[model samples]
Target chain A: MKSLIIGIVAGILCTFSFIPQVAKIIRTKHTKDLSLITFSALSLGVFLWLIYGLMIKEFPVIAANAVTLILSLTIVMMKIKHG
Target chain B: MKSLIIGIVAGILCTFSFIPQVAKIIRTKHTKDLSLITFSALSLGVFLWLIYGLMIKEFPVIAANAVTLILSLTIVMMKIKHG
Candidate 1:
């Protein structure tokens, strides 16, 4: 139970960590300092994580990576648009 | 196994994703556009993941998050120093 809760919180933190970056970019339209390669790599990585989760049949990993992928992609798009 | 390989690749991608960002910041030293909150929260998240990995006795998880934590913290520090 403790492990599950901790893991869930950890997943949530890592997944939503991209949210603020997205909001900042949208609000300021300033992405000059954000690295396109970083976000692109992250998105690909998260996508693989989602695949791994699916293979392992773990809902938390799948769900977390799904949300993370979207946010990371959004950042990538914003970086491209604003770069 | 295929699963292990995929997971390892995913972990590598995610873990090293921050490298380019760090390199960019060091080169440019411009973080006005970077989101401090994003990196800070990400560092926290990665730290928790390390703890979770330790608790669960998962070497891959622990190792990945350990490196990620350092990289993410470096980012947070750069954000603070530059911003």
Candidate 2:
């Protein structure tokens, strides 16, 4: 039970870390300063995590990485759109 | 052995995902678009992961999260310096 709670907290903190950045990007419509390489790498990394999670059958890992993939990919798309 | 390899691969992908961004930041020295909140949250999250890794006595988890914390914290510092 404790371990599960810890996992959830860690997952939430890490995955949701991008929320503020996403909000800022949407509000400002500026992404020239954001590195495409960084966001792209992040999306790829999260995608790999999603796969790993699936392989291990870990729901928290899967859910967190899935949401992270969406958020990171959104940043990548916005960078492309505003680039 | 397969599970260990998976963990290593996932850890590498997720933690090293910041390398490109760090390199770009060093070269271009632009960080105005990167959100303070995002990096701060990332640092906190990674720190939590480190603690969790320690608690669980997981070497790979500890090492990966430690490296990630350093990289993410570097970005945070750079953002401050260039903000």
Candidate 2, position A42, lDDT: 78
- DockQ of every predicted complex: 0.84, 0.63
**Whole-model lDDT, candidate 2?**
0.87
When just chain B is superposed on the true chain B, each candidate scores a TM-score of: 0.93, 0.91
Q: Pick the candidate with the highest lDDT.
A: 1
Candidate number achieving the greatest TM-score relative to the actual structure: 1
Model 1 agreement with the true structure over A2-83: per-residue lDDT tens digits: 8878878888888888888899989999999888999999999999999999999988888999999999999999889988
- Scored against the true structure, residue A62 in model 2 reaches a CA lDDT of 89
The CAPRI-style docking tier of model 2 reads medium
Interface RMSD in Å per candidate, to 1 decimal?
A: 1.0, 1.8
